[model samples]
Target chain A: MLSENSDKIQLFKYLEGIFTELEQQKIALDKSAIVAFTDIKGNITYVNDKFCEISQYSREELLGQNHRIINSGYHEPKFFRNLWKTIARGNIWSDDIRNRAKDGSYYWVATTIVPYLDASGKPYQYVSIRFDITKQKNQELELVRRSKQLEDFCFIVSHNLRAPLSNLLLLTSMIQESDDSEEQKELIGRLVKPVHLLNETFNELVESLQIRQDTDIEKVNLSFKDCLENAMEALNVAVLYPDIEVHHDFNEVPDLKYPKKYLDSIFQNLLSNAIKYQSPKRKLQIRIKSYLREGSTWLEFADNGLGINMKVQGHKLFGLRKTFHDNPDAKGFGLFITKSQIEAVGGMIYAESTQGRGTTFFIKFNAK
Target chain B: MPNDPMKTIDTLYLIDDDDTYQFIVQRTLNSLNLVNSIKLFSNGKAAIDFLEATLHDIEQIPDVILLDLTMPIMDGWQFLEQYLRFRPRIGKKVVIFVVSSSIDPRDMQRAKSISEVTDYIIKPLTKSKLISMLHESLES
Candidate 1:
C-alpha cells in the first residue's frame, strides 16, 4: 500500500522494484537448469517448468511420483544405491545419469543432487540441478566404439600378416639345416609355397581394405536367379560336380536393389564353397532360395556337403583368412569379403552347420 | 634319468595348418634327434579329437604338444578352451607350448593366462632354440 506522503510512496516503489529484479533472476536460473525437488523418501515434491518440459511431465503428474518414474534402467542398481546413500547422509551427489522421457527417448544429464537439511541437521529435501549432456555422452560412446574397431583391425592385420612371414623364416631355416644337394634343391623349390601365400594374403588384404572403405554403395535392381546363374557359370560347378543336384526358388523375393559386385561375390563364394566341400561318400545336393523375413529379404544357401562344425569355428567364421576345414584349396578370403560386402549394404551374414551333415548360410538383404 | 635329453621325450605332437612349417619343423626335429617319434596334425580339430578319444590312455598323449595359434577347423584358442574342460579327465600331465607367428601382445597375454599353456614361442623356432626348450622342460 502506498501512503499519502510522497517519501513513503517512493520507498514502497523502491522495495517493489528490488523484489521484481530478484524474481527475474530466479526465472533466468530456472530456465538455465532442469530443477527438481524431492522429499527425503525420494518422492517428487516440486519441479520447475524446465524440468517438466525436458521430462514431458506436467506438474500434477509428477508431484507425487518418485524419481523412478523417469528412470531409464540403463544404470546398475548399485549406482542408485550409492547416490541415495550420499544424499541421505546430507551430502551432495554428482553424477551423469541417463533418464527416459515420456516419449520413451533417453537423455543424459550431468546432475548434482544437493540435500537440504532441517534445524536438526537431517536431510529433509534434495534439489537436483541437471544440465543436458546427451551430445557429449553420444560422442564418448562413438569414440569408444571406433577405438575398439581399430584395435580389432590391428589384431586381424597382425595375426594374418605374421603367419606368412613365419613361414618364410622357417622355410629358409629348414633349407639352411639340410645337407644333401638334391634335398636342398627340393627344399628351395618348396619356398614358393610360403611366398605364394604371402602374395595371396597381401592381395586379400588390399581387396578387403577396399571393401572396408565402403564408398561403393551404388545399387541397381538385380535378379537373384540371374546373379546366381552368372556366378555358377563363372565357377563351372557343373563341370566340378555333374551329379550335384541344384535347386532355386526365388518367387517370394526374386530380385534386390543391391550392389552388383557384392551380389556376384556373395553368390560366387557360397556356390564354390558348397562345391569345394562336397561330401566324398555321397552325391552333393544344393538348394538356393530367397524369402522376406523380419523386415529384410534373406537368401538361404543350403548344401548337403561336408558341413562345418559350427561349435568349433563359429566365432571366426567370417574372420579374414579363417578356414574351418583341411581343404588345401580353402583360401579363407571368400567368406571374409562376403561378410564385409553384406554388412556394407546394411545387411548381415551367418551360418549354421553340423560336421558330416550339412551347412546352411543365410544372407540378409535390405527389403528395398 | 636318461643321459640324453632327446630320448626323454619319446614322442611329440605338432599341430599346425601350415605345411611348410610342418615340413621344416619335422626335419629340424629329426636332424637334432629330438624325439624317437613325432605325430603330426594339420589342425587343432584332429589333435583335440585324439585327446578326447585317448583321455583314459596315458600312453596316447605325447609328452610335448606344440600348438599353432591359427589353424583350420579349430583354432588354438578354441582348442585350449575345450582342453580346459577335459584336462582333469586325462591321465597324463602333458605340457602344451603355444607356437604362433603372432607377435601381437594380445596373443602373448592370452597364452600366459591359460594354465594349460606352459609357454608361448614366436615363429621361426630354430633348431638351437628347440634344443634349449627341450632342456628347460626336461630339467623341470
Candidate 2:
C-alpha cells in the first residue's frame, strides 16, 4: 500500500513540473508577440501588454473594444469575411494585415488567429498572435512602384525615342538613293529637323530622369518674384515683347522653402505654354498669385490665351506626348515634366480652362 | 520604261501622328512610281471621318491604308473597333497594314488577330518592304 501511494505522489510531482514549464512558455510568448483573445462574435475579451503597446491604445480603452477599432481600411470587406469564415469553422487564419494605431499612424502585422472549439466542433473563442511587419511591407510597396516606373520608361523609349529615330533612318536611306543633287539636298534638309527632334527628345528624357533621381535635392527659401523674373529671363527673346502684361500679388504668402531648379522650370514651362498658345484676337495677359491655405502653400497662374476644352482635354493635359493644338512647335514635354517635378516633392498641379478663352493653373505645395 | 497604269495604287492613306514619319513616308512612296495619290491623317479619328464621308465616292476611297498605333485623340485599337462596325457598308476592300515601332509581342499578336488587318509592319518602313507589301496587296 505504501509503495502504491508513493508512485501516485511521484506522478503528481512530474505533472506539476510540466505545468510550470507551460506557464513559462506562455509568458515568453506574451513578451515577444501581440497576443489577444476574442469571443466567437469577435468582441475583445483579453489582450497582452504587447498588444496595448503596438496598438498605441490604453489597456482600459481596448478591453471592451473589437478589432475594428484598429482597422486601417486597407482590405476589402471580402477579406475580413473570408478571415471570419475560416476562424469560425475552428480553423487557423494567417495573413499580413495593415492596421491603424490610435495616433493615426499605420502599421503592418503578420498575424495568425487560432480558434478554440467547443464540444459541438464550433469555435468558442479565438487567440490571435501578431508580429510587426511594417518595414518589410513598405519595402514591398516601394518595389511595386519602381517596377511601374520602369515600365513607363520602356514605353517612352520605344515610342518617343524610336519615332524620331526611324524618321532619321528613312531620311538617310532616301538621301543615299537620290542621284539628283537637288533632290538629295532637299532630303538632307528634311534630315535636319528629325535629327534636331531626336536630340531634343533625348535631352528631355535626361532632364526628367535627373528630376526623378534628385528626390533629396537641396531646397531653400525662395522669393516668388525672383523666381518669376528668372523664368522670364530664361525664356526665348521673341516671347518677351512689350505688349505682354504681367501682374503679381504675394502679400498673403511671399516665400516658400522649395527646390529652386524645379520652381524655375515650372514657372518657365507655364509661361511659355501661355505664350505659345496665345490667341491672335487678344493681347497676352498673365497674373500670378500666392497664398497659404489649410497648412499648404498655393500658387496660381492665370493667363488670357488660347485655352483648351476642359471636357475633352482635361484628362490628358498632363500626360506625356499628348498635344491639344496644331501648333508646329508643340513638343508636348513641358507640362509632363512640370507635373513630375511637382509630384516628386508631394505637391500637385492642376488646371482649369475654357476653349478659346484662357487657362489657369493651380499648384499646391506639400505642407511643411 | 513606261509605268503600267494598272500596277499603281489609285489612292493610299497614311494615318500617323508623327509629322516626320508622314513626310518621309510620303516622299519615299512618291518616288516609287507605284502610288498615284497619298492622303495623310494625323490620327485615327480624322481618317475615319474621311472614310465615313467618302463611303459612296469610290474615287476618293483608298485601296490601302497604313495605320499607326499610338496617337492622341484616337488610338489604333479604338479606330479598329469603330472601323469594324462600318466596314461592310463601305462596299470597298481597303487593305490595312499596322506600322508601329512597338516590338512588343502582345501588340503584334493583337494586330494579327484582327481579320481586317493585312499584316503588321515594324518601322522604319523601308523601300523594299513597302514594295513587297504593295505587290502583295495588288495580287491579293
Candidate 3:
C-alpha cells in the first residue's frame, strides 16, 4: 500500500512539471508575437496584448470583431479564399498579409495560422501568429520601383533622345551644301530650332536623372488652388490664353500632403496640353475638380479641345517621345513626365478622351 | 515606258516634317534640273488626301515620292499601308524613295520588304545618289 501511494505521488509531480513548462511557453509566445484566436467562423475569440498594440485597438474592441475588421484592401478576395480553404482543411496557412490599423496606417505581417481540429477532424478554431514586416515590405517595394524607373530611363535614351539628334544631322547637312551667303544665313537662322530642341531634351533628361538618383522627396501640405495658380502664373497662360476659360472646384478636397514639385509639374503639364491642343473652331474650356471618393482623394481635369482618338492611339498616349497631334511644338514630353511624377508618389493618373470632343483625366491619390 | 531616256520625271512629292530638309531637297532638285515641279507636305495625311482625290487622273499623281519615315500625323509605314490599299484604283506606277536620317537596320529592312519602296536612302542625299535612284526607278 505504501509503494502504491509513492507511485501515485511521482505521477502527479511529473504531470505538474509538464503543465508548468507549457504555461511558461504560452506566456513567452504572447509577449513576442502579435497573436490572435478565432472561431471556425472567423470571428475573433481572443487576442494577446501584442495584437491589440500593433492594431491600435483596445482589447475590448478587438475581442468580438471579425478578423476582416483589419483588412487593408491590398489583397484580393481570391487570396483570402485560398487562405481560408487551406486552414479549414486543418492545414497550417502561411502568407504575408497587409492589414490596416485603427488609425488608418498600413502594416504588413508575416503570418502563420494553425487550425485546431475536433474529434471529427474538422477545424474548431484557428490560432494566428504574426510578425510585423512593414519596414521590410516597403524596402522591397521601393527597390522594385527603382529598377522599373531604370528600365524607363534606358528606353528614353534609345527612343526620345534620337529625334533631336536627327534634327542636328539634317541641319548639319543643310550647312554643308549651301552655296550662297544669303541661303547660308537663312540656314543658320533655322539651326537655332534644332539647338533649342536638343537643349530642351537634355534638360528633361537631367531632371529625370535627379529624380531617379535621389528618391527622397520632401512632402508638405499643398493647396490645390494655390499650386494651380502658381503654375499658370509661371507659364503666363493668363496673358497667352486670354480667350481661354478656366474653371475649378476644390471645395471637397482643398489640400493634400505631397511633394510640391510633383504637384506643380502635374498641373503644368495638363494645363499646357489643354491650351496647346485647343481647337481652332472654338474657344478653349477647361474644368478642374477635386473630391473624396471610395476612401481616396480624386482630381479631375477636363478639357474641351481637340481630344485624342483613344481607340487608335490609346496605347501610346503617355508613351515617351511620342506625338499623336500634327503640331510641330508637340514634343510628346508632357504626359510622360506627369505620369512619372504621379506614380513616384504612389498615386495614379489616367485619361478618357473622345476625338474632337473632349478629354478628362482622373488622378487618384493614396490614402495616408 | 521602262527606262525611256527621253521621258524625264516632271513632278515630285516631298512628304516630310523638317523644313530644312524640304528646303535642301527643293534647291537640290532645282539646281540639278532633275524634276520640273516639287510639292511639299508637312505630313503624310495631306499627301494621302491628294492621292485619293486624284485617283482617277494619273497625270495629277507625282512621278516619284521622297517620303520621310517619322512624320507627325501619319508615319511612313502607315502611309505605305494606306497607299497599298488604293494602289490598283490609283492606276499610277509611282516609285517611292524612303528618306530618313535614321540608320537603324530594322528600318532599312522594313523599307526593303515593301514592294512600293524603290530604295532607302540615308539623309543628305548627294547628286550622284539622286541620279542613281532616278536611274534605278527608270529601269524598274
Candidate 4:
C-alpha cells in the first residue's frame, strides 16, 4: 500500500512537470505569435496580447466578436468557406490571410488554425496561430509588379523599335534598287522621317527609363505658382497659346517638395496636350488647383478641350504609343512620360474625362 | 510556289496604324504590280467597320487583307474575334494575313491559331514574301 501511494505521488510529480513545460511553451508562443481561440461557430472566445497588438483591437473588443470583424475582404467568400470547411471537419487549415486593422490599415499574417476535437471527433474549438508576414508579402507583391513592368518595357521597346527599323530597312532596299536620280532623291527624303521618328522614339524611351531608375533625384520645396510659371516660360506657352486662358487656386496647398525637372516636364506635357487637343468650337480654358487630402498633396488640372472617350481609351491612356484621337501630332508620349515620373517617387496620376466635354487630371504627391 | 509572273490580287486591304508603313507598302505593291486596287485603314476598327458596311458588295469586299497586330482602337486579335462573328455572312473567300513588326513567337502562334489567317508575315516584308502572298491570294 505504501509503494502504491509512492507510485501515485511519482505519477503526480511527472504530470506536474509536464504541465509546467507546456505552460512555458504557451508563454513563448504567446510572446512571438498572434494567438486566438474561437468556438466551433467561429466566434472569438479568447485572444493573446500579441493578437490584440497586431489587430489593433482590445481584448474586450475582440472577445465574443467574430473573426470577420478584422476581415479585409481581399479574399473571396470561397476562401473563407473552404477554410471553415477544413476546420469544421476537425482538421488543421493554414493560409496567408490579409486582415484589416481597427484603423483600416491592412496587414498580412501567415495563419495556422488547429481544431480541438471532442470525444466524438467533432470540432469543439479552434486555436489559430499566426505570424506577422506583412513585410514579406508586400515585398512579394512589389516584385511581381516590377516584373510585369519589365515585361511591358521589353514589349514596347521591341515593338516600337521594330516599326521604324523595319521601315529603314525597306526604304534602304528600295533606294538601292532605284536607278532614277529623282526617285532616289524622293526615297532618301522619305527615309528622313522614319529616321527622325526612330531617334525620337529611342530618346523618349531612354528618358522614361532614366526617370524610372532615378527615384532618388533631388527635390526642392517650390511654390505652385512659380512652378507653373517656370513650365510656361520653358514651353513659351504665353506666345504659343495666345488665346489660352489659365486660372489657379493654390491657397490651400501652395508649395510641394518635388524634382524640379520632373514637375516642369509634367506641367509642360499636360499643358501642351490640353492646348493641342482643344476643341475647334470652344476656346482653350485651363484651371489648376492644389489641395491636401489624407496627408497627401494633390494637384489638379482641369481643361475645357476635346475630351476623349474614357470608357474605351482610359486603360490605354498612359500606355506607350497608344493614341485614341486622330490628331496628326499625337505621338502618344506625353501621358506615358508623366505617369512614369509621378510613379517613380511613389506618386500617382489619374484622369477623368467625358467625350467632347473636357478632361481633368489629378496628381497625388507622396506624403514623404 | 514558283513566281506566277506578276500576279495581281483583285482588291487588297492594308490595315495598319503606321502611315510610313502604308506609304512604303503601297509603293512596293505598285512596283511589284501585285495589287489591282488598295484600300487603306488606319486601324482594325475602321477596317472592320468598312467590312460590315460593305458585306453585300462583292466589289467592295477585299480579296486579301494584310492586317497589322498593334493598333489604337482595335488590335488584330480583337478584329479577328469580330471578324469571326460575321465572316460566314460574306459569300466570297477573303484571306487574311497578319503583317506585323512583332517577332514575338506568341504573336505568330496566336495568328496561326486563327483558322481565318492565311499566314503571319514579319515586317520589312521582302520582295519574295510579297510575291508569294500575291500567289496565295490569287489561288484563294
> In terms of TM-score, which candidate is strongest?
4
Put down candidate 4 lDDT per residue, A1-368, tens digits, no spaces: 99999999999999999999999999999999999999988899999999999889999999999989999999999999999999998889999999999999999999999999999999999999999999999999999998886776676677777878888998899899989999999889888777877787777778887996787799999889998898788778888778889899999999989998888888888888888878889999999999999999999999989898999989877877633223434555778999989999899999999989999999998865
Q: What would the per-residue lDDT of candidate 1 be over residues A1-368, giving only the tens digit for each residue?
A: 34458878788899999999999987887989999999998899999998899899899999989889999999999999999999999899999999999999999999999999999989999999999999999999999998886677666666666766776777776677778889889888878876777777677778877887866678899999999889978987668667888899999999989889889989988888788878998898899999998778999999998887787878767775533223544656778889988888888889999999989999887645
Per-residue CA lDDT of model 4 for B1-140, tens digit only, reads 63566566779999988887788889988987768899999889999999999898988889999999888769888999999999889888898999987777778898999999999998887777887788877876
lDDT of 3 at A227: 91
CA lDDT, every prediction? 0.83, 0.86, 0.82, 0.87
Scored by lDDT, the top model is 4
Q: True interface contacts reproduced by each model, as a fraction? A: 0.52, 0.39, 0.07, 0.41
Per-model TM-score, in order, reads 0.81, 0.79, 0.64, 0.83
The true-versus-predicted C-alpha distance at residue A294 of model 2, in Å, is 7.9
* lDDT (tens digit, per residue) of candidate 3 on A181-293: 88888777877766776676677767655664545799899999999999899779878778888899999999998889889988988998888877889999999999999
Docking category of candidate 3: incorrect
Q: Model 4: how far is A184 from its true place, Å?
A: 2.6
* Per-residue lDDT of B139 in model 2: 69
Which ranges in model 1 have alpha carbons more than 4 Å from their true place?
A: A1-22, A53-59, A176-179, A212-223, A250-258, A272-325, A328-336, A343-368, B1-8, B48-61, B72-93, B103-107
